[model samples]
Target: MRRFAAAFAAMLATCPGLVHAAQPCLTAAEASSLTAYALPSAITGTAKRCVPNLGTNAFLPTGGAELAARYAVRKHQNWPAAKAAFLKMGAKDESSAFLANMPDPSLQQMLDALIEGMVAQQIPLDRCAEIDRVVGLLAPLPAQNTAELLAVMFGLAGKTGKAKNDLFSICES
Candidate 1:
């Protein structure tokens, strides 16, 4: 019995997702909203402009859910740190043209998710509002070639099919 208990404990320690599953990063409503959301108009315009620039990256099989999971784990559930890392990953104007085009609602959704994810992770909340303010002020977007950029962002957030389909729909228009 002792050996069996030890092995089970070892497995749990090695698989962070298993632990997270018991404490989901997103609430049922949030998860449903994320999956059900139609591509916003701002992102649609960006996708239309950027799809042609997809190159080989679109073929790469990276799902948004997996990326979110990795991100959730990587930041140890710290909201502010995750926001910084996202911007550093070239989400700023220096790398993404779509940033300039994104609508305020879309941006708000992303910010809300960050805060919610952090809260779900059990991060201390005393500074959350302050962090939100700072992050909003610092966020930037690219001025050109934004389709591929937005696609990557959607893919990372676990909405690859929606991203591709939306871009393709725009191309057809």
Candidate 2:
């Protein structure tokens, strides 16, 4: 957990616009703004379908190293196909627009969760690739890029807090 936290801190340091005085959680105004851009039902529905397949074992802490290894392998194998899909989705431009429009910390955390969820699931490599690509594009922008990524991810992962558990399930067989 310390290692993950350290890595996350490092990520924040490298990425500008995300270095704000931390708040404990999202404010009502922030949540309301996020809801305004809520993901379409179709996308959220797909996430719901995918979640169960991840199973209860998906986010176990005991298999962290093994899960990380598997995720690396899956990411390597699927990145190309996923990149093509990302371009097809026109996420590149859309991502840039999202970054320009919204730069909130809550949204950034949402994006991080989404990406982490994708890495955990390791099945929908295409969407994972899209999120990864957008994240890269947002690297130079403000930290909100990360937030937008999470919002999209939440939309993809059923927009529920429970979906975060999927991040720990990566090592499940």
TM value for model 1 = 0.19
User: What are the lDDT figures for the candidates, one per model?
Assistant: 0.29, 0.33
The list of candidate 1 runs beyond 4 A from truth reads 1-95, 122-173
The true-structure Cα RMSD of candidate 1 reads: 20.8
| Residue 5, candidate 1: C-alpha displacement in angstroms | 36
Q: If scored against the real structure, what TM-score would every candidate get?
A: 0.19, 0.24
Summed backbone clashes in each candidate are 8, 8
Q: Model 2 misses residue 114 by how many Å?
A: 5.7
Task: Mark the 10 consecutive residues where model 1 has the least summed lDDT.
Answer: 164-173
Residue 130 local lDDT, model 2: 41
Check candidate 1 and list the clashing pairs.
50-147, 64-157, 64-158, 65-158, 96-142, 97-142, 97-143, 99-141
lDDT of 1 by residue, 1-173 (tens): 11111222232233222222221233222222332221122222222333344433331112223323332332322333323322223323432445334564565465444333322233223433343333223223221112234333433333334322211111111
